[model samples]
Target: MATFLYRIGRWAFRRRRLVGGLWLGVLVLAVAAAALAPSGEEADLAMPGTESQRAFDLLDERFPQSNSQGAEARLVFRAPDGRRVTAGENRATVADVLGSLEGSDQVASATDPYTTGAVSEDGTIAYSTITYTADAVDLSESAKAALQDAASRARSAGLTVEIGGSALDAEEELGGTTEIIGVAVAAVVLILALGSLVAAGLSLLTAFVGVAIAFGLVSALAVPLGLTSTVAILALMLGLAVGIDYALFITSRYRDERARGSEPEEAAGRAVGTAGSAVVFAGATVVIALVGLGVVGIPELTKMGMGGAGAVALAVLVALTLVPALFGFFGRRVLSRTARKGMRPGGAARSRGREAELPGRDAGRAGLGARWARFVLRRPVAVLMVAGLGLGAVALPALGLELGLPGDESKSVETTQRRAYDLLSQGFGPGFNGPLTVVVDTSESGDTRATTDLVVKTVKGVDGIASVGEPVLNRTEDTAVLTAVPRTAPNSGETKDLVHAMRSALSGVSSGTGAGILVTGTTALNIDISEAMSDALIPYLSVVIGLAVLLLTVVFRSVLVPVKAALGFLLSVGAAFGVLVAVFQWGWAADLIGIEQTGPVMSLMPILIIGIVFGLAMDYEVFLLTRMREAYVHGASPGEAIVSGFRHSGRVVAAAAIIMVSVFAGFIGMNSPTIQTMGVGLAAAVAFDAFLVRMAIAPAVLALLGHRAWWLPRILNRVLPDVDIEGESLSRHDPASSAPSQTSAAEPAPVRQLPVGRD
Candidate 1:
């Protein structure tokens, strides 16, 4: 694999123009495809095989005109203190607002508060309902503007007006400011790590190009594939992060090779051959984890996984080809001024002669990583215990984790929808914001009306049921739909329990009357989605953990090493979930992170954290451990191998982890609660996995295990194909040779023997 990649890198560097031009042409084609494709629609939140989904499908088929299936807006009006909404001025204002809505072509119907008995007992609060002709996603901007205009007139007449409902649920605009800030921070980190402006700029440039191409492709294919904006957003985030990091790794390796006295082209080839191999494997692991989201059987999550996987794949390709070609253009300028000055004519020959001694003999000028590794070797047990206990303490809160879909109550207090929700709850009850719809299919019943009446009565008898609306039958009288308001808030545990109780009670009625009964609504849909996610969590974890262990075993060629990596990943995930629960569910210091209202964590957050964090955690593990394995194979003692690995790969891994955290943390500023939750969760997970698990606990564990850390069964070693991920084959080839040729497997280099050491 290293030989193959080495040839491609050298070829790309020699033919820089052709390689660069091809990527540019591909970018142009991607842009054109995006421009010509139809615009993408919002993500579909439909869950197949769930009761609420089945109920919804039945409504669309049997009662197409049912108000339950359409978008609606409630114009909540509150009069001044000591005044009633029925007073002359307030009543006239409320009437005028309803009249304007009735005149609008977008409105199917506008119900007056008086006629519908929507006024509160004190008459100080009232609300008028306006049903739209289209779904929320399909509603025209003009329709929303018209609604806002009507509310303004009511406010002008001295009545407090707020609008809420599906009609007002527009997609929030995600500005590029956050992305720009993240990229700027990454550039600074790169410059500091590489110590060259040219190198930092090159990394940023390649990452931006890769991300743009991936985003364009995803956008062009979105409509055809039924993908949503959520997928695109996630794709962009992961793509940008991995693209920059991959380029940074290759660039850092190229600089190191140059410093060791290799010519420009040779250094570029060796860098790509070595670091590029790690990039490919790391990227593959990420792709596998993402594509594995299909096991959850959720269409939205599946799309998200595929989108993220495509981005990572593109990042890998760009790093291997475009990066090397760009290196050719930059040539010697990629090195710092000091580094260029230090190079001499015979340095390459001298460096090659001492290659065997380089790994263990560099201890005199050790960096922070080397110092840290020495400390871990001295007190491995203490370091491991400290890291484990700290992470476990953080993870303890996960036992109280609660998952649910974020609703209007989770929105910022400044949003009109949240204000409307609060007003409705005050006037009526908390359940008013989330009414459950009971659908009774009476097609097989002898008397449809009798069956519908019996179903409604049984629902009303449910303990948590506040009230059941009158049943409205379809034109064929085969389906009857009624609204059931619960006695608690939409996201409350009681509401979820009420939904379950209503379903159980309705089952008996269905059995008696031979009618098909289903309970559904936004509230019920959320309940079903949450439950589905919860049930799939364990299975998804098993698949992801099993895959990670198998892949790591192949890369590291050790049983205990792979098992240790998997366990560390579990700790990272647990700690991440614990933090999420503390902030979003328990409201622990929520205001510090811009969380205005706290509720149950988003249902999709845990699965998303596991899949994404597992992939990234493996990336750090591979990049760091491969260096240690390479040092050990070349004859460095276990203690020296740990120091050698850190000296070479520590800076790059730290920079990459920091870049990822910065990019994800930028999303915390977003207005949407769902995006905000994702930002905080992913950022925290990466931080824990990168610093605590990989950097601290992993080294300590490896130090304690010593030579046994790399042990593999003889039979298993022979069965598993050697992947050559560390590019050891590159070391045997002559650096001065221009022609890229495969090396013979029969001529394996003998390992150098070093003195054994006991810490």
Candidate 2:
């Protein structure tokens, strides 16, 4: 694969324009096709085979009229003078607002608060309901615009108007400022790391081009794949971070080769052959981890995973093909003139001679990485024990982790939905914001009123129950729904407990009265989703971790290496989760990140973060460890190999880490709570994995293991194919030869005797 990549890089460099034009064509077509693709939000939120899903399915089948599937807008009308809404002026204003909504073609129906008893007892507030012609996510922009215009006019008429619900939520604008800022921050890191404006600019350029293509593909796939609008933001996050990192890795290696006195063309091939191979393997690991999200059996998660995987695959493609072509175009100018001049003042031939004799003796250098490597080797056991203890201490907070959906209260106060939510909680109770519907089927009981009475009697006595609305029977009288309002807020643990209590209560009622009772609604659905995610966590982790371990074992040709990598990644992820619990769940400095109130971490966040961070951890692992393995294969002493690998890859890995951290952290600026959760979680995971796990613990453990780190069973080694990721393919054209070739590098480092095991 490395040789094939080298050949492609060399060919693309020789015909740079053709490759450039080809990428240009892809970009153009991607944009055009994406623009033409149908788009909105496609929500496949049904968690099949769960109790809540079953309840919902039963409701939809048995009582279509009672199903809450249509688009709805909740209109909160407030009296500015603190007068009763029933007063003449306030009443007229409320009526006028309802009339305007009713007159709009976008509204299928408008329910009056006064007539429907949807008013506050004090009469200072009243809220009507507007049912749209289609689902909120499917509503046309013109319809949403009309709704907003109506609200504006209502506000002009002396009424404090606030709209809430999925309709308005769908209409919320997701600005690109977050992506722009993230990319800008990443560019700064790239410039600082690469030390050249052109190199930095090319990294961004390659990332943008690749992300543009990925964005178009994700948008186009949204419809067929049943993806939500959130996928676009997710793609942006993954694309910018990985795209930039991929180019940085490849570009950094190309510059390193140039620094070693290879010609521009030869350096490009050698860089792609070596670092580019790592990029391929790293990207594949990410894609594998992401696509593995499908095993969780959630459609939304599956869509998210597939979208991210597609974006990463494109990033790898662009890094290998487009980046090399661009480098070819820049040639020696890719390096600043000072850098080119500072290079060893010899052509490829003399450089090969120098490189041939440079290894083994270079181990005692005083570079920071080398010094750190030496420290680890000198006291590997102490370093491992200390780092392990620290990681465990940090991970302690995660034991108390709770998972739930963020309620409307967690949303930005600036949003009308949030304002409405606050008003609803104030006027009614927190439970008013998330009413639970108890569905009772009377077909078996043959007495609708009897079943209804039983349900109300059973639920009203529950410990946390606030009130129960009268049961409303469908036209057929076979299905009845009783709305139960709890005293606790929707996202509170008490509310989830209340759901369980109610379900148990209803089950007993059904058994006694021969009626079928099922508890469901938004709150219940969230509870079920949270529980399902919790239940699936272990299985999901086992699968993803197991696959990762197997892949690493095959790639690294070692059992202990893969085992240490997996266990170390888990420690890093657990520590990241601990940070989340302390910051968001425990409310430590939450306000700084725009979280006004701490709640359980979003249910899906843990799953998504684990998948993403696992891949990212593997990325650093492969890039860093592959260098060490290369050194080991050259027969350097295990200790020398560790020092050599850290010297070569440490700076690049650090840069990539900083770049990824910046990109992920930038998403905190988004207004959406979900995005904020993702931002904090992903940033923490990457930070722990990069700075703590990869740089600290991994090296210490490897140092302690000595040659055992590379131990593989004889049979397995013979059976497993040699992956050739060490860029031996570059030797085909012998770029380091005395006579110049189109693609070659400094003469391959001479092999020394492998060190015997230390322990």
Highest TM-score: give the candidate number: 1
The digit string of per-residue lDDT tens for model 2 on 36-115 reads 98875646366777777777887788777645557888888887775777888777777776777775766788888889
lDDT assessment of candidate 1? 0.84
Estimated TM-score for each candidate: 0.93, 0.92
**lDDT digits (tens) for residues 1-759 of candidate 1:** 888888888888999999999999989998899889876667548788999999999999997656455688989999998899988878888888888877685788988898889998888889988887777877888898999999999888888999988898865565557756877888888887776799889999999889889889988998899877778788888998889989998998887776555777887898888898989888998898899887787889889999999999999999999999999898766766556555566433124332211222222323767788788889999999999999999999999988899888988889999999999999888998899999989888778888888887888789988888999988988998999999899999999999999898888888988889999998999999999999999999998999988988888788888999999999999999999999998888789877888888999989988988888898899889998988888778888888888888887799999999988887777777878888889988999999989988999999988888888777677677888898877876544333222332233335744222232
lDDT of 1 at 81: 86
Candidate closest to the true structure, highest lDDT:
1
- Candidate 1 wrong stretches, greater than 4 Å: 36-38, 66-71, 102-105, 133-141, 176-178, 345-366, 734-749, 752-759
Model 2 deviation from native, Cα RMSD in Å: 3.8
Q: Give lDDT per model, in order.
A: 0.84, 0.80
